[model samples]
Target chain A: MRDRINALARLVPVWAVWLGYGWVAPWLIYRGATGGLGAEPIKALERELGEIALQLLIIGLCLTPLRRYLGVNLLRFRRAIGLLAFSYVCLHLAVWLFLDVQDAGRIWADIVKRPYVTVGMVAFVLMIPLALTSNDRAVRWLGARWRRLHRLTYAVAVLGVVHFIWLSKGFQIEPLAYLAVIFALLALRLPDSKSLERRTR
Target chain B: MANRWKNDLRARDVTPEAVYLDRRQVIAGAAGLGLVGTGRAARAKVPEPNAWEDITSYNNYYEFGTDKGDPARHAHRLTVQPWSLRIDGLVDRPGDYDFADIMARMTIEERIYRFRCVEAWSMVVPWNGFELADLLDMAGVQAGAKYVAFETVLRPEEMPGVRYPVLDWPYVEGLRLDEALHPLTIMATGIYGRDIPNQNGAPLRLVVPWKYGFKSIKSVVRITLTDTEPPTSWNKANPREYGFYSNVNPEVDHPRWSQATERRIGGGLFARREPTLMFNGYADEVAGLYAGMDLKTYF
Candidate 1:
């Protein structure tokens, strides 16, 4: 009990951040539901949530790189950041499916036919395994294979950026700028000694 | 394929053709060149000029750039001054028309039209320009001319996207000659009581609100009359994704998303998308022209 309590203590700050954001999403939904969103509100809400999801994803991806660079060892909080990212993504998908599309056939087609949505769906699927295995027991049971499986995060990161760029119908630089920052951070892992830990071990 | 889809949807009996016909007349009138003879005019009810204007001026042609608001923001880098429109192929007069001379001789007029994007949001705006027929007449199209292709300016220095081939650069769009000469088709220069901002396809742009936004070509530097369906930039890049017609119909959804509704920009969250209209509500004037034809196939 004491050990579990201590573990919970370490997770508190991350949960607070996720909870704060999650709390605000409902207020936004309420405003949207009550007709506060106005003529183009559905799209506006979807766009806002999509951006939030992207930011959360970026933040989650950043945690690992930041830990290594800063020597902060904040790996304990990575799971929370990732789960929050997934939660926001779920919200984004919900808004699109229910509020925007409102048609299951079309939504299913989008997931199947559209390259952007396909990649996004794949990234989401990959995330599920990571999220499921994030607990201590799964990590211990999976042991050596677990870290290898989680490396799929890099693939998810790349897909997330591609999804963003694809969604922007026109050639705008804002998405590109986001991609550049994420790319630079992820690229650092390519030649780093920490990434090659197995050989040294 | 487009025709089959429309026919299949028609067979579904969910959306009535009568409802679609009500709006089709306006689209035909706007798209009909002066050639839409007198017999056709009396049969179709004239649509009232559109009443809104905010959505007309703001747009994004991914062929040019990607922000929903970017075209109206970056379009100015294209210099309209000393503009020369090169007209060639299947035309009696194959030459360049200087912008100043064209503006000087053409009868310019202002018409208020509702601009509906395929995205489903819309705005009514008054635009000032000459009928495209007037320009085509100036060039004197020949008997073989079936389509008029418009080429937008390509300059990496001005249009940064040119270097990347994000799309087949120097976007190309075409219209059937009749469609090109439609009374509603305008080579516009100004909007909202002001000279069009650089971002709004300044110098000139095509305005075909009934069709998808891409049909309204921008920053055109060349016009070529051809005998065959011209290869459109978007269609060439992804033919299955973007058809030649690209008409705005909610019933026919995009492969990746539904076309049933669109968010009118500037409207807050939770707002429902307005129902999409057939031929963007101009079917009455144009439907009979394709009475025996299939729109889904052409689209």
Candidate 2:
């Protein structure tokens, strides 16, 4: 089963994944521009972009677990997934800055004053270094430090979910569900008791 | 109806039918001309009532569901025909008031007023209903009454949202006696000369123009004249975020978001966010209601 999965993964090109996922941002923009996203299109577009970015982040996090537990190694496409998630995050921020809240001063005020907005901004800022160093050259240059730097993804994931939960009105389950899923994914990454005992021995 | 308050906003001020009915086509055309995000800076000063589609379709009536469109989709299941309102507490003639009888007795009139939401979105609506003062008077408000409390219908089988504790069920809202008695306050029954669609609070709903839209509770089932300030649903849910006196003051920002500006519904995708007015542009008439008090603190 593992060999079959590896063979199938080899058939799909990383460039194909990049091209297919990259089209989502432009497609969402087109829908918003043409009024296909319903009334309050800008808000809908912003939310869709944010959700897609979150999904991509979740998918990117699943790559290692998929390989470890199932021996299904599609690790080659992780870079594309990570870059796509970053691209979607950038699109989400653009829609919010340019379409939703168009005032520069107000945007600054929100980032400084609003707790949810501040959390979201911090997550986005943290993503900048990770995105900048996603290339093979940086991995080769930094060696062990590159993996340490990429661990920022864990902080970004938590902050993103926190931002979602804080911005939601009343007691909503949707954002909380995302929080649960992200927590579960992070928990899966922790070394098991047996593994810890073996390493200590 | 002759003595009724005149409509300062005329029918022409309503969003154009072509623009609303074929909104996508119009937006597509605008996008073709590179005018999509140009903003509404050069437009007329008078606020336009949103299209009937926008008014009825977009709502925060969580009785049906939390999403804005959920009410429109699920409200049809609501039975509004057999509706009756219970008027009790501190009233001389306390009893169940039949909806039909109440409609027949009251003088219904048109009121085009600005409706602002706490989420910094707004719309102008032409509400058709009688002054809430008239209804309270019919129930004979007692001299000891200091506040007016309202309750929304709670049918868990019909209102799917009530199945969950999204908010404490049987959504409640209240206003100080003077605010409830204000002429600007009405029990809205219809929109644009038609019976309000179930989604937009059919049968009966409070329309307090000076307050945030949530304070104007929808599908009201009970009203009580009380001697003490009553707890409101949103306030009960989050005291820091929602206050009892949720008057629309641009200066008092919601803890989570700024209330300084609002995006007008039916203003198209690229229209500029307009600065929110004190009392949602009815400050001249309603500002006196909050005199000698700090709105920021109350908010």
Candidate 3:
């Protein structure tokens, strides 16, 4: 009973994350809906969904580092956070597909011809299997292979950053900064790289 | 949605009549160059007059920066004095025309028109310039010429965006011979009865009211009469999103955005969207130019 309470308490921060900016995409979007999204509402909405998805992906990537250094075991919430990221990614693409690009032929042309759209589509494709196999049944069925399959998250994160960089016009530092942080987070996951590991409780 | 406008702003020319008369002479000498067909076709019906801040500050001259607000902030660094225009390629007379010489030969007139961005934002602007057809005639277009290509100045030191590959350096745009010869095509030099600000393509710029705003290349330095179609900057960068013939077709949507409707720039977030018009409401004047051609296929 005591262990159950402790586990529930640890998950509070996770719930906060699920409700906070790291995962509170729907809520933020709801706010934009109520107040209005500026002159070009559809464009603004499309960009917001894409940006929130990126931030959620970054936060999802940081879970391993949190466990390694701060001893905050967020592993329990990783699946939920990842699925949220995927949902946002799907939503982002949906907005672009349905509301923004109404012409079917143009949509195909954009996905095939534009480098930025191609990269973004590739990233979204990489997330589909991860989201589909996220349930306990798939985990139990695949066992060890599930971990291997889910490892594709690393590549998905990298592609997401690339998509952002390519879409931006001019030499913007914000997307570049996201790239740097993502690289650092991935580097921390290296097998022998334990420089930041906490020594004691 | 027609382009025919009946606005009070035309009645209020902020410039004094004395100076207005002095400037009016620029257009007086030109033979048979009437202010493009707004009266005959009566297409555009623009609503509110954009505020001075919106007119001067809100611009998208990507050579200055990609952001709409960046041009007004960054374009001041550009030098417009002693500018020259190169009129060449498939022409009888091909040479560098000094800014003073070009202005001397051209007729300037006020043109209040609806300006629409492919991003689906719209604005109304009053511009002063001469018919581009006059300049094309002055260059003596060869019969073999089938297109008119325009190139913007590339000053990396002054235009910071040029330093980065936001787009190809020296922005280039083109129009078919028939489209280029259209009466609505003007090379704008001023706005609101004053010399155009540097951000709004000071000295000179192309204004094709019937096409997407990007078709109106800014800070123009080169005008070439070409026998073949020319590659445009945005179309070259992302051909899927921006077509070479970026005529304001309400039916053909952009790859990632809708062209059916537009948000008026100053209309606030929740304002009703104004329906987009075919050829930006200049359909009466330009629809025949694309007869038998499928805009969607070319688009």
The candidate that wins on lDDT is: 2
Q: Put down candidate 1 lDDT per residue, A1-201, tens digits, no spaces.
A: 545654665777866776767776787787665445433557666777777777777776776666556544556667877777777778878888887766687678788878888888888888888888888899999999998998887777778778888876445577798789778878866756765796788
Q: DockQ of all candidates, in order?
A: 0.30, 0.65, 0.13
Predictions in order: lDDT: 0.69, 0.87, 0.78
Model 1 spans with C-alpha error above 4 angstroms: A1-45, A65-72, A102-201, B1-57, B61-64
Decoy 1 TM-score against native: 0.71
Error of 3 at A16 (Å): 11
Candidate 2 structure, TM-score to reference: 0.95
Candidate 1 per-residue lDDT, tens place, B1-299, comes to 00111111122222233543343344345436664355335422332232222243346655446655555556667666878889999989899888888889887666555567655566545667777888888889899899999998777777654656567778899988878877667788776445766666767888875688778888778999999999898788767668887877777776655677665443334334566677776676455545775766776
The DockQ-based CAPRI class assigned to model 2 is medium
lDDT of 3 by residue, B1-299 (tens): 11223433463534344643343243233214775344223324425345555577677787777666689889889999989999999999999999889888787777777899887788878888888888889889999999999999998899987766767788899999888877788889988777999999988999999899989999899999999999998888887778888989889877655688786764332334668989887897788988898999877
Q: Considering only N, C-alpha and C atoms within 3 Å, which residue pairs clash in candidate 3?
A: B2-B43, B2-B44, B3-B43, B3-B44, B3-B45, B4-B43, B4-B44
lDDT of 3 at B56: 79
* Residue B98 lDDT (model 2): 98
Instruction: Output the number of the TM-score-best candidate.
Output: 2
Q: Candidate 2 on A60-170: residue-level lDDT in tens? A: 889888988888998999888988888888989998998889999989999999999999999999999998998999999999999999999999989998998998888
Ranking by TM-score: 2, 1, 3
Clashing pairs in 2: none
Best by DockQ: 2
> What are the TM-scores, per candidate, against the unseen true structure?
0.71, 0.95, 0.67
